[model samples]
Target: MEKKADQVSVWCIVSMASIPLVMTLGNSMLIPVLPILEDKVGISSFQSSMIITSYSVAAIFLIPVAGYLSDRFGRKKVILPSLILALIGGLIAGFASWKMDDPFTMIIIGRVIQGIGAAGAMPIVLPLVGDLYQDDEEKASSCLGIIETSNTFGKVLSPILGSIFAAFLWFLPFFSISALSLISIVLIFFFVKVPKEKDEPVKFKEFFNNTKKVFKAEGKWLYTVFLNGVLVMLILFSMLFFLSENLEKVHDIKGIKKGFVLAIPLLLLCTASFISGRKIKGDIKTIRLVMLSCLAVMSIAVAFVGFTNKKIILLLAVTSIVGIAIGALLPALDAIITENIEKELRGTVTSFYSSARFIGVAAGPPIMSIVMKNFLNGSYIVAGVLGVILLFIVFKFIKENEIGNQTEKA
Candidate 1:
């Protein structure tokens, strides 16, 4: 009944972890290689940005649908097909990049397809993780933390992997998506054994009504979590984008050097997530404190960044602090959302949360590109203010409850 690491094969956790990592690498691994695409395809920079945006945009709209379907049919049912679809999209993009004279359009098309598949992939994994250790909050929180870490780790690895893959052939990163997805698909299929649901799938009308009731009961806390998810992701990606640009433009750092420099904050984030996940362990009080503290720290660090000049070392130092805060916040937020929600509702709610995250990803670069370029230090100031706003929301709205004692029904 208690699906601890020993009871549930560590391989199962690894399989689940692969979903987020591959999902991340699938999209992000293209960032550093975008310039190469621009050179090879003769596309403008804005057009190049669209290549990345298309995938996220596609995922954003479909994620809730995917979540609902997963809840109805099963997570594995949704995830396997989605992984296959994502792999297909990667191959399409890879082939077009390899063989086409004018590959930009096809590449975009492929990315959109991949995005559609992604809507069902990583988003679904959250609920599945929740399902795994349903009777064991400590393990569940730890597993969710691992999932979040894998996702952040992918962000840290993306630029480096993109550059390395591009060194062999510009199209290799596109193909890499397929390779990564295939790995996830195989691992998931063989190792991730989801527990069977005893209840018959609810009809759509009943399902919709139950979802509404859930919001009615938990809307305040849930909304705050969703907002925080969006805000943190938006700020994180925006900061990374800003850093990547300045690393090359201002510091004259480029290529692998730029990737390593860009990775510092992300590595901080990844480490923070792992440690926070271990510490929280489904303690409701600890979760709330972690959220509040992380948000407070993030706000202060970002405000400091706003005041500081664009000196590379100072910027990295402040941003790395922000990264750690964000990294810590993620697991706390995730554990709360996952542990408190009813099992039947977990898939859909987490889907919405994942969609909020994708919204941030979709908007971050373009938003930061405009804000940082024109508004100067205004970007950090805005983010700092938003972080403060989240701090207030979390403190005011997140009620103290014994999450481990939550009643489970499916």
Candidate 2:
């Protein structure tokens, strides 16, 4: 069952890319349609936000375990089962919405199931790319960029797709998740081939010890990257959730039209991330510098939003800047975390990083609900402060490519 590393086909890459693409859409696609969901389900914004939180919370705990399992077994083995579980989770949510009188609890429980599946499918894509091109660093780097781009592309499309689905039937996006995951499952099963790993599987104790050693040496920088992941997602999702309401209620925009306006920042993010990833490439110093610069830029833009006087154009423009800043910073975070980690430990470490990001996603909406209700004008200010704190952390703790040099030497 061992395959040649160089045998990687374009179809193979495309198949692998589908996992993140679909998994992201499963969550993000809900944002635009949340207003409708709130009304249909007779749920408060806070309650509706729990739908998102439930999914993320499940992933937040399970991703690290999925990472360990992927390392111990094989990437495909873990991913295939995860997609099946996600598909089932999607059905439960969809049916509860469609068929049940009191579906709220069922829907939440279903999302938790989906979240469990998400923990495995989404984060595993990273280390799998690294494994696929073990012999060719350039191709590994290129494919990683592709994976990130696919993920961002999902963000760009999700709102529109979600809105379109909702416009037809309020609960349709829930069912769509099942369809999307099925496609990825098929593509990966038939087309992709993982080269066999040569290393013996490490036991739980040794695995835990290795993780400790890796974290001990690089914890300063890795923890910074993990925090950055969380904060960026927190800002991104909270704003999107906030804006979805603003568009539907305040601006009287809804359906596909609203989805497009919401997509503006996401489009900016998707475009900028692709450009940033290409430019930063494995240059650790460049990655850290870009991230620092982006954090500062985003912090300023978010604070400016507090003073925008609610001018539609001004608000959108400023938020767009925040999106672009995130776009630039994320690729840097990914590069610094994964490229520097030794291959054997990449799955566990990146899973932890992915899990941290989910913490932000889970926290964003409910926290934002409170922020908007209590301190509406200061929402931007509070988010800005978090950005500034993260910027300071990156500058002080994230060494400039030093980890990369150390990794190369080791």
Candidate 3:
């Protein structure tokens, strides 16, 4: 029986890992193909960009609800339905792009559906991993580390995949994302098997009341840490939006050349995430030190991006620095939150974290684009300043608590 349980645990990790991979791959795959969509769909640039924003906007509204449902029901219940929704969304977008002459409205509708589906997928997966390895901090962190790496890996490869598909057909990327979502659905059905909670079902009104109590119970410092994590995402993505535009428009770089430049930072980010996952250990103070150092490095890198004229090398270096910072920051934040929050409310709190992150992702590009258009000279400076502000919040507000009890092994 013990051996059987261990085997189940291994399967659970693999299944959970797939969630991030599907989300990451699907999200990243579209970055390279935006221009193709513009020409094929006959939409304005703002409309084309909405293809990305629609998903995130939907995520912002749906994630908290999904998170609550997962906690009240079960992870698998939420995940399976979400995967099906993603498939529907993907097919809609692909068909619209392929068969319709006026595809923008259809595509946006599809993206919104995908975003709602995504709300149920990625955010819940983290807490599921927490559920799987409840008792061992190191093991749980390691699991999250793997998930984060897979996420970054998807970002790293998406452009390459997107470029290849765009060469053949612009609509191919949506199909690719749909295929991944389908695969994830199959994996989850076969592999994930967490025992359902035995507690009596809580009504929606009662659930929100419980959530309110949890929010009130958590210390101010914990909430601040959560906000800092959100800010990190916002700053990183905002910079990415600006950097991608700068390389393409200002530097006159396009096609694979632009993709290559954009990829450098992601490569560094991937490397940094892997390294941080392996090296980071111990109390909140240790985590704080690592986070602070990463933030400082990121600040320097963004400042360089603002000041430099040699776009290629500057972009590469800055990306590396920010990548390293973010790589460390994500898992560290996850581990911190998981360790600090009570077990019963973990999913709900994590949902809030996910919502904050989606907010950042949704806001980053448009906000940065506006800044670049209006104050081209000061965009990177703005990003750098925000990074510093995050750093200050972390150092001053975050507290050092002992790591909590780990999730019980299956």
Candidate 4:
């Protein structure tokens, strides 16, 4: 039974990891091709950004509902259907791009469907991971790191892959996402083994009561995590939007060249997330120290992007450094939330966290576009300032608490 559980745990981790990877690829992959999409669809820059934001906006609103459902039902039950919705969305978007006279509207609609699916899928993984290793904090922490690494890996691949698909045809990326989502669905259905729950499903009234109780007790620290989540994602997507736009508009770099160039910072981000996920484990001290240091590093690096010139090498170096900071921040935040929350409450809490993150994603590109249009350096300055604000919140709220209780697992 022990060996079997270990094997199931490993497979579950792999399957859960794929959830974020596919989600990132579905969204981030389109960043490099937004210019092409703008031209092909005859949309304004802001409208093109809406392509990305629409998906996140939908996810932002629906994520908490999905989280609640997953807690009430089961992870796989919620996840499998969500992937199906994403697959349907991908196919709809791809078909519209290939055959329709006006594909933009259809594509946005598809993205909304994809967002609904995303709301249910990735957010459920954190709590499911907690359930898998109920007693072992170290293993759970390492597993969560692997999950974060996969998410970053998708970001690393998105630009390169999206650009490659766009080179052949602008719609190919949508088809690619459909294919990826299909694969994820199969992997999850066949191999991922969720541990059986012994407790009866909580009634809606009790669920709400538990949720209220949790916030009353842990609201300060949890709110800090939520804010940090939004800030990091905002900084990340904003910088990516800036880099993708600048590379094509200013340097005339496009196609695979642009993709590879855009990927440099994300590669660094993936590396940072992988390392941080493992090192932070379940230690609250580790989470605090890592987040504080990384937030400082990110703020300084983004400030440089705003303050400096359009020198290509300098921008890449600074963005790459910022990527490292974000990478560390993500898993640290994930560990803090997942390790501390009770299993029944984990999905709901982390879903709220994920929703906060989607809000950042939804806002990043459009806001950055407006800022960059007005003043090139202003975007980076704005990101840096936000980072500093988040750092202070973390410093003030995230403190040493007694561990060992299920709700306060340190």
- TM-score result, candidate 4: 0.97
Poorest 10 consecutive residues by lDDT, candidate 1? 401-410
Model 3: CA > 4 A from native: 1-8, 202-206, 402-410
- Model 3, poorest ten-residue lDDT window? 401-410
Residue-level lDDT of model 2, residues 1-410, one tens digit each, is 13564347889989988998999999999999888888888999999999999999999999999999998998889999999989999999999999998899999988999999999999998888777666655566667777887888899999999999998999999999999999999998998788766678888898888888888778888888999999899988988888888777777888999999989989999888888877876776787789889999998898876465356688789889999999888877777777777777889999999999999999999988777766766878877898999889888887774575553333
Per-residue lDDT of model 3, residues 227-340, tens digit only: 766677776666666665677667877666666667777877877776776566535776788778887887767766656634667667766787778877777777777656
What's the distance in Å from true for residue 397, model 4?
Answer: 0.6
By TM-score rank, best first, the candidates go: 4, 2, 1, 3
| Local accuracy of candidate 1 as per-residue lDDT tens digits, 1-410 | 45445536889999999999999999888877776787899986567777878899999999999999999999999999999989999999999999999999999999999999899999998889888788888989989999999998998898888878888898999999999999999999999888877889999999999898787767788888999999888888777766766777677877777777778888899999999988899888899999999999998898776455368889899999999999999999889989888788899999999999889888887776666666857778878898888889888887686233323221
After best superposition, candidate 2 residue 61: deviation in angstroms? 0.3
Worst ten in a row by lDDT for model 4: 401-410
Flag regions of model 2 displaced more than 4 Å.
1-6, 405-410
For residues 327-375, could you state the per-residue lDDT of candidate 4 as single tens digits?
9889999999898888888889999999999999999999887888777
lDDT score of residue 7 within candidate 4: 47
Specify the highest-lDDT model's number. 4
Candidate-wise lDDT, in order: 0.86, 0.86, 0.74, 0.89
* Clash count in backbone of candidate 1: 0
